[model samples]
Target: MSEPFDPARWRPAAFLPERDVRDPALIFAIAVLCFLACLTALGVIAGDRAAHGWSGQLKGEATVIVRARGGETPDAAAARAAETLAGVPGVSEARALEKEKAYDLIRPWLGDVTDLEDLPVPRLVAVSLDRKRPATATVLQEALKAQGVDAVVDDHQIWIKDIRRAAGVVRLSGASIFLLIALAAAAVVAFATRAGLAARRDVVQVLHLAGAEDNQIANLFELRFARVAAISGALGAIAAALTGALLRLIGGGAGITPALPIAWLDLLAVLPCPLLAAIVAVVAARLTARRLIQDL
Candidate 1:
């Protein structure tokens, strides 16, 4: 097993500060900003997918639309097709569509169920295939033809493919956005660390003149910067979470489906982000200090 990282004992005081445990406010800020952005993006992507994918579960029930072709009666054709499908292998249940039920399906767009009487609503059969090795279109097609019903199969795979592609795009976009956010976070840390170092330059100069090692001076800055980063990161994360929750509540509706819940796991999963920000600040500080010392 890989050993855990011990920041204190891992390097000299120049790289690892003794007083680093104070607070990491700035680091926390950057991390929380990134985490919130990531979570929001994820939620948006998830909600879109869930709504599109699970809207109507057609997989569990196969629909056979018997066209009113030739001199064949639509009702008769549907009944014959339903009987054939029910007898087919791997078919658990089959039923011919009742006129009231068929009209109700079109009632959404056509207004009243009575309005669909003139519409050529073809004979319909609802079939439930056994879970194991469900019947295929080829088998069902042949059986329907034998029963004198012109039937077509719609498995909804084409639309599902399009949705999957959209999901891929969403995930890719989210990744890219988060990457940019992280870069921004690193830049912020670098800037803050430089500012901190500049403010303490006189103290550092005095320490150096007093025969204190470069490592000792570096340690003080690292500790201070790390603390600032940590605290800031935590605050940012909390704020992000609260904002997300509020938005979720605002958008909550029976008709609306969210991608995923903004749970503790996502929040907790990125808790180490603040530490990473602090590390960036510390490194930036170290590099600036080295440059300053060299120029002297």
Candidate 2:
């Protein structure tokens, strides 16, 4: 007597008892892949934030270095340059740094020497420009020259350009890493699906002979892989979140900006990694089963 089909009594994974042993390795691989993908996504977010921060801080700002010569002190030269810059059309404000502060800036490279004051350190003038009517380095230099102040203008554009280029490289590298991890995850799921199919070949052949559809057989593999992937991916995502949090805490303690900025919008990008991993596993399993089951 043929029993009626009852969805509640059907469990596809029951076809092979050995799946219990093999599934752990597959799950672990998926978890590692998910961890790497999440980390790369976080890296992309951090690079974007850092690039924006650098651009915001450096745009429309410049530095003036006043050289001391002909019996003029660095402070006097800096003061004259600041006074000249104050009247410039595009310049908003200028301030001369004190000698002690200047010495502190170079203390990192040159150790504390008692004759530090004797060193001819050029005075530094920080200049702010109105973005609406930005001042050019050439114009600032001409203004300083007209006032007989020997100074060099650094508009910081070069540094900003270098920072932007570096950010681009980081973003590209992160994307490449993400792609490789995703490919590796798909390969792992495919291999596991094929192994499971082989282990249950006899059952699959009987089901095929008994008039089961190809998709029906494929579903058996997909469901198993998808469930495993979801659990493993979630574990990996949690680990990544904890790691990011720890790094942020360390960065805060060290008085440095964290690579991963904690923002709701940025975190939203990371939240989908586990779900995407599950989807990848499901699709890989389905495709692998469909192709391999045809010979059965």
Q: Which one is best on TM-score?
A: 2
Give candidate 2's TM-score.
0.75
Instruction: Give the 10-residue window scoring lowest on summed lDDT in candidate 2.
Output: 253-262
Q: Which stretches of candidate 1 lie over 4 Å from their true place?
A: 1-63, 68-73, 79-120, 125-149, 209-214, 248-270
Model 1, 1-296: lDDT tens digits are 98998887875454233343322554554666656654554454455445444533444557888777777677877887888899989788889989677777767877764456567787678888776667877788888788767888655556656756766666667667767777777788788788767766777777777887777777777777766776666566566656655654665742223454343334353556667767877888778776665555
> Per-residue lDDT tens digits of candidate 2, residues 1-296?
88898998987766435457777887887788777777667666777677666765687789998998799988999999999998899989999988787888888899887678778998899999887897889999999999899999999989989977877777787778877876776676666666766777777787778988888877877787778888778877777776666666666732126444544345456577667767877887777777767876
The TM-scores, one per candidate, come to 0.66, 0.75
Clashes of each: 24, 0
Among all candidates shown, the one with the greatest lDDT: 2
Q: lDDT for model 2, please.
A: 0.77
Question: CA lDDT of each candidate?
Answer: 0.67, 0.77
